[model samples]
Target: MTEFDAATAIGEGGTAELSDGWVIGEAVNGGILMSLATRAAAEALGAAGSHTDPVAFSTTFLAAAQPGPARVESQILRTGRSFSTAEVTISQGETATLRHTATFADLDANSEPVHLQEAPPELPDPESCAPAARGGFAEKIRILDRLDMRIDPATVGWAVGQPANDGEMRAWIRFADGREPDVLSLPFFLDALPPVTFTFGALGWAPTIAFSGHVRSRPAPGWLRMRITTRNVIGGLFEEDAVIWDSRDRVVAQSRQLAGVRMPSAPVSP
Candidate 1:
């Protein structure tokens, strides 16, 4: 593995800030922003990846952050032989945006049994979905104009013009200027979409409280396909479970998140 500049930014006050490229809904994607903060946390603790060592990461999104310049700070919770734990906080202006906890671990050989539990659903070709025409990450954060997206028609493909990660959402992501897609390259996958969930009348916008994932496998580059569907929304909280697949129908990484609905701006459980 090679070292790359963290997708997230370091805070002037020792906190990580949101990338100017990250925008979501009325605000930036807190999940992605928080994920980067966790990465910064790992780097601060000297647990980041190197040419020979790769680290697994898990993160939590504690609050919804408005769009603006932001910052993040991390604390090393603990370090063990196989894994290290860290906590991070994200801020916009002065108000706290999100808090995250993460774990980084070096890979090791184990004789445990392996299993493939889930697979992507058969969906239309990415070209078949409706295309969004949003511009850069600044104007439209949630709007994707890259790959085709169909919430109702629902299949697996990319959401071009959005974050691109080999997952449940096939996003047409262009790298920064001269950057190329690689393992070390930061993949900007939108882990959360609040408006879609709110439009369903199930619950409106809910700030993400936390996000966590275990690295089961790494992905290959090129345009990828991602599929996501809301499974449950209740008690002022909603959950999204997603699956990611590559061009060859290969299952990539899997991720899930839980968010809290704050009403009006969000949804009431009634």
Candidate 2:
């Protein structure tokens, strides 16, 4: 099997480079980019270990990426006792691709627990679903090939897929083409539940304004179910909140992102 360990260092400095195997498509997606940035930031901070979990990240897509050699540069803005902040610029060849910032913090005990407003969508047993893997690139966006998923529709309630990797996970994902997913693609997986709360009309086509995620604990290897909802939609901007649950149905991580309905054709400001 082709090997692409997120823990491995691809490169570092004001600029860095990394490599990933080609999946259904030549380009990378949100999750891979996030992992690259997270790894770069953790390495830069001299963090005790590979980011066991991601706390928060904000990425902007400047251009689409093609599979092959890639590079990432993580800039440490500040390091504090409780928290650290950094920025990452990802690119391929000479063209700049994506830039984003991230914040990491050590978990503390004093953090108060919050009440649960809603439960996650139930999913089918991952084993029941058939594995779908094709050799070449897919015509439409599909992330099923990279994972093991089961979709009984009526019985499962929703899609339940897990990555073949050791510990990392992504959940609540379907294919862009509406066909059963081919692999667990990162972008759509991370974005799936966030916009569910918004009436389809309220979620106008918009670019991501910002994204943030917090690591609660090291997630177990299994199909994690995620529930996403639109928290607020106002002033042409919307915020989506994501809650990820493990196989046992325990919340593991939470993420939030903001986007605006109207975006200029020009680059987004930092």
In terms of TM-score, the best-performing candidate is: 1
lDDT of 2 by residue, 1-270 (tens): 122233124644434333333233445545556656766676767654322224566777777666656777777887776677778787888977778777766534212263552455655555544333334423323434444433233322212232111112223433323333111123234653313322332222345556666655434455656655564556667676777665555566677777666422332222
lDDT of 1 by residue, 92-156 (tens): 67777766666655433321234554665666654665444346532465424222234323322
lDDT of each: 0.48, 0.50
Query: Residue 43 of model 2: what lDDT?
Result: 70
The segments of candidate 2 whose C-alpha lies over 4 angstroms from its true place after superposition are: 1-9, 12-26, 47-53, 108-118, 127-142, 151-209, 230-240, 258-270
lDDT of 2: 0.50
* RMSD of model 2 against the true structure: 9.5
Candidate 1 segments exceeding 4 Å error: 1-7, 11-20, 47-63, 107-114, 133-152, 155-204, 247-250, 260-270
Q: Which ten residues in a row have the lowest lDDT in candidate 1?
A: 158-167
Which window of 10 residues has the lowest lDDT sum in candidate 2?
158-167
TM-score of 2: 0.61
